[model samples]
Target chain A: MSDDKAGASPAAAYLAIDWGTTNRRVYVMAADGSVLATARDDRGIKSVEAGCWADELAGIRARFGDLPAIAAGMVGSTRGWREIPYVIAPAGVTELATGIGRIPEERFFIVPGVAYDTPDHADVMRGEEVQAVGACLSGLAPHDALFCQPGTHNKWIGLKDARITSVTTALTGELFALLRDHSILAEMMTGPVEDGPAFRAGIADAAGGDLLSRLFGVRASVLLGRRAREDGAAYTSGLLIGADVAAREVAGRLVHILSDPNLGPLYAVAIEAFGGTSTAIDGQAAFVAGIHHIWSMIDD
Target chain B: MSDDKAGASPAAAYLAIDWGTTNRRVYVMAADGSVLATARDDRGIKSVEAGCWADELAGIRARFGDLPAIAAGMVGSTRGWREIPYVIAPAGVTELATGIGRIPEERFFIVPGVAYDTPDHADVMRGEEVQAVGACLSGLAPHDALFCQPGTHNKWIGLKDARITSVTTALTGELFALLRDHSILAEMMTGPVEDGPAFRAGIADAAGGDLLSRLFGVRASVLLGRRAREDGAAYTSGLLIGADVAAREVAGRLVHILSDPNLGPLYAVAIEAFGGTSTAIDGQAAFVAGIHHIWSMIDD
Candidate 1:
């Protein structure tokens, strides 16, 4: 059966864009988040301009044809194409649509990102709010969600019911990038690595206690001749993740990690901390879900 | 009558040389490591022609007259003048003098350093070993000792009695340097800081656990405005140190720290970790004691 709408055959082709500092991706989803035709562009928010963002969107149109779409990430913020205002977390579906915009080709809504007025400074979320919204819609989100997103800038966000309430970011990926690649941790490492049991051992060490000292141990382990150079980087990777888990020490919370698997070995560690109740969503999936949420809000 | 030799006054003057990768200093001591006439020279091992090392001694003679002297640091190693072999820990007076070297008219012995030879690589300590040797001389040293020397490359040496047994180095200072002056942590920091209570609070955080997560909190605190940038550095500093202490939780071991008084705030944090039972030695005094150890070995 050909479901046609708006003078075209319809597959419920909904478009989603997850754009950030260095990478950009676009996906065509069904009414559900099942990816249809996916396309990507290298010109992320940092490298491209809001005016140029349309050009990247053109790439998606070529793959899936003209369709209704929703966007997330910097795509919706003040720096983005339409400057979608942020919705303070704990906002409802109505608040989520406050800053959504109208795209020329399709009826699109830019999801309202989340923010908080912290004591010292205001903490804001752009692309991540979409993920929380997606999680809420996926029916996978736990009651009190402790979202752990590990990446270049790892974030741990909390959601009550279906709204993001609090969030924190960790420069674990950047720190690891520095120590293993730039600092003495590089010396302990061999260039191409298979990561001996040391990665596991490091995870154990981080779990044993002394997260920061153990983190420092990256240099000390190299200096002490306990680990090789290439392994040192892996050790540092484990150190930060282990420390993250060790620090959070979440016993009963339904911890959810929204991050790239390639970023670090944090997902496994988070699972170890939060136990069987832990759920991990791929960065791409959460992003798509976030887009669907914004699209759903646009019609409302 | 004290080693009375015809017309000879008791060796009233003693010389000490501290030479390392980038800096060298000559100190004229009153046979007790007390500074008398001190001359700081720029020519370190990396900069000096080894053949000129003898001339450098003559230059010392020109500054403080003819005097018996002792040399510490890398000066005695293969990198410096006449290679002084390493002495395994539990080093004694006789074992130390076995590596003695004398320039005509100057009585001296270069202190033997220590090294750890493992399967992959070995770490050799040239100067720190001397300090550990000095630490061994103290009457308080037990069969097993834990020495903490805080600096750019913090050293934590584990000794079995008199012999310098095993050791580890923490890049605590280096991390602080990188974070405060070079990395992301610098972004939040402003002007000079007293650190104050934030320092202790950071330590307390490490003690609380989740070192990796706590480290992330350093950047979060500042970025979120929970802490002042200057205080962020201070807080991060304490967190790193506290993580180290909390990680190395040895219940009954005697913990002794060799550090400059300038690190008083950090020392206060260390005291909080190791407890008041932890004893601290002045870094300057340890330098003197180290040189004395080398000299006594020579004279004996």
Candidate 2:
């Protein structure tokens, strides 16, 4: 089971896992960095009971063979399978590799998340660091660039000289979901969120006032009959994303966006609307690539 | 039963009701503006079953005796008993009184909410208008001042020459609750929210960036051990209210805050922290006074 053994089978491959809050994606890769097999499950760290992660990993190994395993994302956080200290930025794959936490029983290693500790704002990211590293390894990222990972907790990372130098996080997506599902505005949003005029109007509204005030317009617009109730979701989405993008320093920069297909289009639209050029990178591809690169850095 | 009878009993009084989304407060007042008796129930407009508001009112009357009742807040909203149109500002007691919609079967009148319609932002308020008017009649408001009503939907009303000239709203309270109960940050928060250093630190964090970015710090601070998890609620509250207050144009103005006792102290702390002076007014007292002033303006 241990890769350090004197003689290993030819079928042995590295297992790269991105264990996040909601999903766990596993990549089986050969020594030359080509993917051999893959598996995924909804048993994210949030779903696993405490002290049961070892059994969960054993279950995965039962199906995919007990190859040397490396994991990233929330799996390294205190809430995850095991705690790995955050390697403070500016850090890249080398520094991150040095901070890897290990599980002796299963030959498993966890890549540390990165943190930016400053007087103004403090930010941290886990899986995104792997994605950023992957983007760099794949030549999708520039030596100096702004990378955006939009999701529940959207991150705007500043990369320089192939290292993550700075990080900022926005709770835009989470806030939007909270409002859509729990706030008074939920009643007004009854249909699918369309990318139309109402969405743009929400973006425009973000520029007028603070987000706390601007959000109220979602309900007011419907009550006034100015907007259909069905448009509430799109409009709310635009307002949150628009405000988030506007607050960034991306007026004339090429922002590299790593997002799932569902969120990528919306981010691209907002980035363009805010006077920035955006390149959408597939999230899963970047995650796999990043995990693979990290696994290669480990010595047998 | 009716106040309009040719020879009415001496105990007949005007009943003022402030029926909001979560709570219902009834104030029985004499013609001279003194509170005779009061009652409260959790049966807000939201809790009342559809087509049963009349029965609810009858239940209140059955206990307190039939009287000409005037109601405000969400009870007059589209989802309430009957939809009363908003009276656009700049408006005061006269404009609000003129827009009152009557329920003929029950001898009930509902005061209209106020709306601000501009190209930039649209805002609507139902119960806060009653609070604003009450503050004015009670001589708690200055001729030109900012009135802060802190609750689920906190309203900041701009009063000029004894009339509500402008209005702004912040979803601070609502957003705080949603995040505390539903969002990822909820797990970090467990104890009652205290007004302490953590709360002030959160307010300071709010002054640094957009709300979307600042909110993420709540989780990061706890995760990094920079702040205790129990402090999450207070910190989040401070961040929300601080961001809201910081965005307003009320640095030097005297702000009259009409709020329930629980939230009033927090707003006072935030208002003072943001370099503005604030006066706390009892919400129930204001509602009763506001409804009395509007009722007295009615032409019999």
Candidate 3:
């Protein structure tokens, strides 16, 4: 069921919409694998009401001209425009292409999400699967590699022979946001996070374990005049990212990170601090390449 | 500075207010260390404006016959009725009584909280110092023991020879509440948390480490149809508590828990599951005994 034979390539251009929960990125790709124009907006899948998906698609088509389209991410989840069932791991381009579902009476298709389930543990990802597979296709990473995709829910994906074998998602960004916006820790964190001494110190402390207790130290240290209040947010970021990296067997490994300009370096430093080497590959480029590869393989 | 000598006991009846951020517990105590009457209200220190503390005290005294009052918890902090400076640990009743700061032109006194500061770590507690000390005085725990006071911010205190030597606080309850009420995980958590198999399974997963990833698994497991939606909250509770317990040297140790009827047993099971023994001491009783002990030693 996962391995459908590749069909003949289409000669026309298509719209690749990476529709996420809060933001949508649209890429107008030519048949020759060049991006003609790209646009991003806050009109993510979550913004559209259930009966308004067609209107939303029509609006996108109104801007870019109606061409065939391939949408991914939350747009295909249960809460999105159409719910596409997840393709189980070990899955790759063929598995994903075969699992793609079509929108009724429209020339629109959705790339299915990926699920990693065992007898004891389970994990899933929607948009990130495209980026991971695309990273491999674009030669940014090897077919057998480890990729760290940092976001609200940071994913640690294990790829084997061009197929995604496992994924571990960490609630680092979301947890940080919650603590910064709503918890008592918010009052102490007035400054922006940077990869500096305070952050590195937090990474060092994370090596000792006990994250919950260490998290409170951010407030307690400031309250007791033992640490500067300005260093609070950075320390928190370090603690969270450090803990995420420390959980893995990264002591002697080369981790390929799907890089965000700001968050990528932090993870790289954290990984290096924890005795791992890393190379950051541009996340957007990988997603584009992934969607393009999938598009090339889709039946005309 | 923490070694003030005990003063002669006062003869008049007084008020013992265990005043925290969100709730206040008042005990009308007799001269002989017995509670005459008790009342609880949501008029915590946070509820009263800074300048209006005098009027708030007036309101309480107006109802309780203008008696002298000793308030603990946030009432002593900067945001409370008055900003009583923290007493450095290892501090006991004599130290707390000596460090007590009085409300200007009033018969009310606020017990100074304790601060455990070192070169690399710092921690402080307002009311829990009293509870931990009181637990020892009330014979619920030995002088040298480990005490876990669970709540929004759960404190892990190390007592040495009846004095608080160390403190480590975890944002377990607050984190749990934030996830349940705000995060994507909230939708999956419709049922109450219990100490059941689902929770134990979470504890087992926690033992494998990588907490941020394990936390995300709560949502993933449910989404993949591998776990029941009803068990989401319990699994989350277990993961958090288990991670907390695992962070400590709880193996073969007896942890003295200041019990909250609902949350106490969960910590107990987590401790025992992680190879530790535990005994639950009534938190309210400890507070009463602690305030009584401090009151008995205060100078008239």
Residue-level lDDT tens digits of model 1 in B218-286: 655554457777677667777777766665664555577776565645754555555544677665556
- Residue A93 alpha-carbon offset, candidate 3, angstroms: 0.9
Better of 1 and 3 by TM-score: 3
Residues forming the 10-long window of minimal summed lDDT in candidate 2 chain B: B1-10
* Model 2 misplaced regions, further than 4 Å: A1-12, B1-12
Give the Å shift of residue A76 in candidate 3.
0.9
* Clashing residue pairs, backbone N/CA/C < 3 A, model 2: none
**Model 1 Cα lDDT, one tens digit per residue, A133-217:** 6676676575457787777667777877777777666666766676665565566655432234655566667666644445555
Task: Enumerate the candidates' DockQ scores in order.
Answer: 0.26, 0.71, 0.76
lDDT by residue for model 2 over B7-54, one digit each (tens)? 133665777888888888777678787776777779898899998888
Query: Top model by DockQ, which number?
Result: 3
Considering the two chains of model 1, state its CAPRI-style docking category.
acceptable
lDDT of each: 0.63, 0.82, 0.87
Q: Cα RMSD for candidate 1?
A: 6.5
Steric clashes per prediction: 19, 0, 0
TM-score preference between candidates 1 and 2, better one: 2
Q: What is the TM-score of chain A alone in each candidate?
A: 0.79, 0.94, 0.94
Best by TM-score: 3
Most accurate candidate by lDDT:
3
Give per-model TM-scores.
0.74, 0.92, 0.94
